[model samples]
Every structure is written in structure tokens, then in C-alpha cells.
Target: MTATLIFLLLFLLGLFLALRPLLGPKEPFPEPPRREELLEELEVLKREVEALEGEEKKLALARMVELERALEGYRPPEPRPFNPLPVALVLGAVVLLGVGLWRYTLPRLPGETTVTARAEARELKALSDKAKKTGAVEDLLAWGRKAFELGVYEQAAEAYMEVLKKDPRNVEAVRRVGILLFLSGRPEEARLFLEIAQHAEPMAAEGWLFLGNLYFQEGRYQEAIAAWERYLEMGGEARERVQGLIAMARAQAQGGKDGKSVYQARCAACHGARGEGGVGPRLQGNPILKAKEAVREIVLQGRGTMPAVPLAPEELSALLDYLDSL
Candidate 1:
């Protein structure tokens, strides 16, 4: 009931507000003039219009006279002299573009003079032959076994290098060079060639073997073994040889007598008969032997050109005994 009363009040208030503006008081109107007074007013208005018309005629005459004078006396100045600045700016911009082309763009264009493939190859052959004739046997051997496999590593390296000089993309030459490098104790250089060879021929056992041998020379035996094993796994024909080497290395590590004998035969060539130091360090008093286990480790592990010798368990014990006696 209260809610109904409130709504009724709001509606009545809105209606009243809307009607107020229209219902408000209006202003009073002015009284009309008499006919005689209106006629007098008209006469005054007519005189004022006549005076305005006379003034307008005078203004029009004065304006016409001024226009006639201006026409007789006025002359336009000659066209302003031409300026060179616009032309100079355009020429400067063109010159700058030409200079830029000469310095940067032109050199890189397709027809720019460059060494031809044949010329490059000839130069490479010349250099390789020069290197070969210089009696760089080690260098040749280090660079050339993969392509020729001719056993004359020095000659092969020269020939391969010549081929590479001419055509660096020659896969066979690259592989041969890498192998030669590996054999020549230049493993670091060989790595690049081997990697390229491997990429070119992934299944090539020779490349893997060379890479493995390179790893071995670098004292990365585990890597070397892995490479060799990979080669073997791929059905390389030298599987037995690799296995024998691995076995020999294992046997040597175990301190076998056979390992000692192998060491004496092979290592003695440089290291001396009595382990008293020759081209290599003296093994007898080697601080490494102070630790019984260390002696065995060195023998089995081998280092730098020393092949891992395969020795029986008993042979290893005898080898250790012999080393101790030394």
C-alpha cells in the first residue's frame, strides 16, 4: 500500500512540472501609431533613402576613377631570375648514388672479375707440387692417403692437394688428405678434412678409422675406441685387427708378461732396454711405478704411439714384477 502511494506522488509531480512552462504569464503588446504620424515617418524614411543613394553614386564614381589611374600607371616586375640550387641538389643526389654503386654494389655484381675454377685448380696443383718436391714427406703423408691409397703417402698428399687446389669439393681428395694428415701426426689439421669426408660419405670406413686413429693420438682413447668400434659395427673388414688392438690394450692394462715383452720390443726402440730413459722417459724409477696400481695402468692404457698390449693375467703379473725389478 505504501509503495503504491509513492508511485502515485511521483507521477503527479512529473505532470505538474511539464505543464508549468506552457501555463506561465505572457508579455504585453505595444500600441499601434496613428495614420498621420505614420505618414510623417514615411516621409522622413524616403528622404533618408534619397540621401543614401546620392552617397552611393559618389562612392561608385570615386572607385571608377581610382581603378582607371591604377590601370594607366601599374606594371608587373620582370620574372625573378632563375636559381641553380634545385638543379644542383638533384645533381648532387645523383652523384652520391653513383659513388655508392661504384664503392659497394658494383663489386658484388655477377660479372665482377673473379678467379675461375680452372685457374684456382692450376694454382693449387702448383703449390702442392712445390710442397711435394720440397721433400715435405711428413706433410705429404699427413695430407694424401685417402684418394690414392698408393702407399706413397708423400706423393699421394701432393697429388691430392693439387686436386683440392683445383677443386676443393673433391670428396675423394679431401678424404685422402685427411687420412694422410692423421697418419703424419697432424691430427688437428686432419680433423677438419675427416669431418668433411664423413659428411660426404657417412659409410666410409676409412674416414672413421682415420678419425679414430686421430682421436687415439690426441689421447682420446675412449673416443678412438668408439670410432673403431663404429667402423667395425658397420661391417668394416678390419674388425679382427681392431678387436686384437682392444684386447691387447686390455691385457697390457692388466700387467701381463706379454705386455711387458711387447713394450720392451716396441717401446725399447725409443725408451731404452733397461727402462733407464732413451728417447722416452726411464720407466724403472718412474714416480708412476711408486704406486703398484699406477704401473699397471700405464702399461695397459699406453700413451702416444705405444699400442695397448694384450697380456694374459699371469703375464701382466710378471710384467709388473719385471718393472719393479727395473
Candidate 2:
């Protein structure tokens, strides 16, 4: 409202300036102050000169002639009224320009943020349609990128997941999908995707940041510290925040911890939410729970399709106790 008022004031001001000159006195130049005095004197001399004769008349007549010449020199030109046609044309043009500028070039009616967001929404929809129609990795990536930039996590995840289906090795898709998952509170799934992305592209600072956060949530304090340190080394923007997280993680490392919580954080994502099994075999009532040493060895060393899961002594002990309970 304030912006509209300001624009209106400026528009009115422009019209005022444009019309001011035409509204002024009709004469282009002002009459000189001395010209009126000269004219009055000339009129008086003319009336008196007619009554005179001889030398007196001759002197008076000469004086009258001199006054007439002076009057001629002082004569003001006729004032010309400003032409209405030109004034009207100029006014029409100015009004049209001001209206057009207000509608197009000036600040929008609502707010710039609203205007920009609406534009983004339209572009996001276009990109999403194109991606769905083509099913191409590039198009999907473009859509995902737009959605991610706009903070629409669900749409971003949909697009990136589509890209991953087409190209499993797409690092950006893996990383972005992981970020979306984390934001949606699916930390376990997020961890899997994030791990893949971070390994494929170690230099990505944002990936490391989330990776650190995932580790922190999982009670893997040492790993969290390392990941956050790497993020800082890579020139992450949230230096102070990451440093604080690292300090907190360090504090957590020294504090007492929970075994079930550790297992859920470290193993539940792949194994099972409740040990019923998914990617890895079922651990619930499994014979492996009775063989603690063998399970520990398998966890520490790569076996079959499973990768090594290195853990600090305390976290490893906690995980083992939790696994036995399973």
C-alpha cells in the first residue's frame, strides 16, 4: 500500500511538472517594468503638444517625437495564449506513459516477494511437467533443482528419485534425495543415500554437513566430528554452527549413552526398524544374536555385499549389547 501511494505521488508530481509550464502566464516573456512608465508619458505629451505653437510648439513637438520613438522602442509584443491542442496532446502522452510504467516497470502491486514466488511456482510447474513428459535424467534433474531451490522438499524428492531410477550413479540425485529425506524425518534412508553421495563426491561441503548431522543423530559422535571437520575444511558457509555441533558431539562422546538408541541409529536403517529385516537379513530371534563375536567380526569386516562399519569402542559395545537383546 505504501509503495502504491509513493508511486502515485511521483506520477502526480510528474504530471504537475509537465503541465506547470503550459498553465503559466500566456506570454513567453514578462513586460519590462520601465515600459509602462514610458507609455504613460507618451500619452500625456501627445495631448499637450496639440495646444502649443511656434518655438514652444516646435520644442514640445520635438519632445513628443522623441517620446514617441522611446515608446516605440519600449512597445511590448502581444501575448499569445498557450495552444490547447498541444497541451492536450502532451497531457495524453504523459498520462499514458505514467500508467504504463506503473503497471509494468514500477514495483508490483502486492510485494516483490509475492511476485517472485509466483514466478518461481510457475517455472517449477513447467519444469515438473517437462520432466514427467520426457522422463529424461537431465529434465528430471532440472525439475529437482528448481524444486530444491524453492524449498519444496516433496517435489524435489520426487524429481530426484526419478533421476536416480534412470541413472543409478547420479551423485547429485543421490545427495539431494538424501537431503529431502532428512528434512522429511527419514534419517535412516537419508543416511544410505548420503553415504553413497559423499563417497562418490568427497568435495561436496553440503553433503558432509548433513552426513555429520546424521552421524550425530545416530550417536556416532566421533564420525560426526570428523564429518563436520571435513565440511569446515571444504569452506562450508555455516562455520560457526558446524563448529558448535562438533563441540556438542565431542561432549556427547564423553557422556553415557543408550544401547537400543545406538542400534536404531547405526543398524536399524538397513536391518529393520524393529529388527524384522529388509535390506539385510532379519535379526529378530535369529541364531546370530547368540554368536556375539561372529556378528561383531562381520560388522567390522566387509562380508558379501555388506560394507565394514567402523565404530568407536563405546558405540561398538553399545551396538553389540543391543544386538544381543534383538
Candidate 3:
């Protein structure tokens, strides 16, 4: 509601400025030259005309006639009638345009957030253009980072992929590309790149964090636990979060998985708590939930960013029951 008010205020202010010229005048009074002044000037001109001759006299006479005409014509001009029709039309157009833009072009976020996003978008374009022209790996990396942060995934992919084409061993590019692929719902490919990145730079803590999450999704509890440990050891941020994950992985490994618990521990972080969707698709209302066999197969074999989540038969049965509820 606050955001909507700010937008409305801004729209109204702009409309006011744009229509300022059309508002006409407030007084509606056109003050012509004073009648006494016109008569005085007319008398002075007549006296001058008598003293002049030929062209000079003719010029004076013309001035006197103009002055007399002004005096004659000087009944205060009538003000134009106030016409609301054109103004109403303009208002309607502005309203229609504002509604159209609100529906399509404007961001739904708060006003400040929307403005910041727009600014970042412009910067992203500038960085992209410069990087394209330079063809430098550093330039591309900068552009890729900006794009990724802005959630312009395709552009981010383009920038990172370009970096790979030029420098295949670039650790940052490799790790980030892997992360992008993961987010793009291609966990299999994401894992390959992430594995290469981890091996190439084991000290890269963030890579370990994601690699751990990937492993956890696959139900490789030990590997996930190990990767997360590595991440913690490397002093990756989110220490507490990773520790929680390690605890969960331990539970899963020990066969303590109830269906809802399994979903929370294995999938909630990515797919959203209520399965409304985040990094993965919304599980709620998904038709696949009705297909127990298909859901089981997908969980076991992995699909998209999900690696095979190998639950024990009992745990799997419980998970299927929980999924059916979703």
C-alpha cells in the first residue's frame, strides 16, 4: 500500500507538470491598455499630425487611427468558456496509460526496490556492452557477476559461458556456471561443473556449500556431510546453517527419515517450505504427486537439479505418503 501511494504521488506530480500549459489562467481578465491613456495618446497624435506634412503627416494620421481603433475596441475582451472536455480526455488517457503500465511495465515491488532494480538493470547493460567490446575475461567476469546478482540468468550464463570459451580453467567462472546450472534445474550438469570446481579449488568454500547441497539432494549423506564439513572448515559464511544441514544429513543416513522430515531436510531449502516453489518447482498441486511410481523413480534417479535421493524402502513409503498429501 505504501508503494502504491508513492507511485500514485509520482504519477500525479508528473501529470501535473505535463499538463501545466493546458491549465489556462486563473484570473480570466485581459487588461487592455487604460481607456484614458489611449485617449490622451490619441489627442497628442492629432496635434502632431497637424504640425506635420506629406509622408510624416500620413504616418501620424495612421498612428492616430490605430489609437482611436484601440479605444473603440477596448471593451474588456470576453474570457473563453471553461471547457472540461479536452481536460477530461487528457485525464482519461493518462489514467489508461498508468493502468496499462502498472499491469505490464512497472515492477510490483516497493518503489525504492523497483527503482534500484531499474538502476541495476541499466548498469548490467552497460557492463555487458563494455565486456562484449573488450572481450577480456575480467570484463566478462564483472558483467557475469552483475547479471547473476540481478537474476538475469540467461545473460549471466552468456557471460560465464564466454569466459569458459576463452579460459576453461577459470575457477570463478566454472563455479558460478555450475551454480547457474543448478539454479536452472540441471543438477546433473551442475554437479559435473561443481565437482571440477571443487577439485580445482578445494579451498573455495562457497563451492563446497553448494556441492554439499547437491550431494544431500542425491541422498549421498556421507558425501554431503563431508562436503559441508569441508565448507565449515574452509570458513564459509553461514556456518550455523551448514551445521544444521550436517545434522540432518546424519539423521537421513541413520534411517530416521519420516516423509515430511525427509522433504524438509532434503528439499525444503530449495523447493520452498510449503512447496510453493523457489529454486525448484512447486510440489503442491503438482500432478506428479498422484503418480507414486513416477515420483519414486524421479527421486531415486534424480531429475533436473535433484540427484537420486536414495531413501530406504520404509522411508520411501513414508515420503510417498507425505507427497500424496501435497
Model 2, 1-326: lDDT tens per residue?
A: 65556666766866886778757766567656587676777788788878887899888788778777776776565777766876676577678767755554343322343456556777888999999999999999999998888787788989998998999999999998898889889999999999999999545899999999999888788888899999999999999999999888866764536566566666788889789998889989999778888888988896898888877777778888877777
Best by lDDT: 3
| Candidate 1 lDDT over residue span 147-224, tens digit each | 243254566776778768767777777888898888788878899999888788545887777887777666555566
* Highest TM-score model number: 3
Indicate the residue-level lDDT of 11 in model 3: 74
lDDT of 2 at 183: 84
Instruction: Give the Cα error of residue 60 in candidate 2, in Å.
Output: 99
TM-score of each: 0.32, 0.45, 0.50
Q: What TM-score should be assigned to candidate 3?
A: 0.50
Q: Select the stronger candidate by lDDT from 1 and 3.
A: 3
lDDT of 3 by residue, 1-326 (tens): 56567667767865885587568567567567788899998888877777899999988888888888888888865776877776777677678768755654445322334556656767888999999999999999999999887778899999999999999999989999998988888899999999999998534898999899999888788789999999998988899999999999888865655677777777788778878899888989999788889988998999987778877888888778877787
The runs of at least 3 residues in candidate 3 whose Cα sits more than 4 Å from the true structure, single-residue gaps closed, are 1-80, 84-112, 256-326
| Candidate 2 wrongly placed segments (more than 4 Å) | 1-113, 257-326
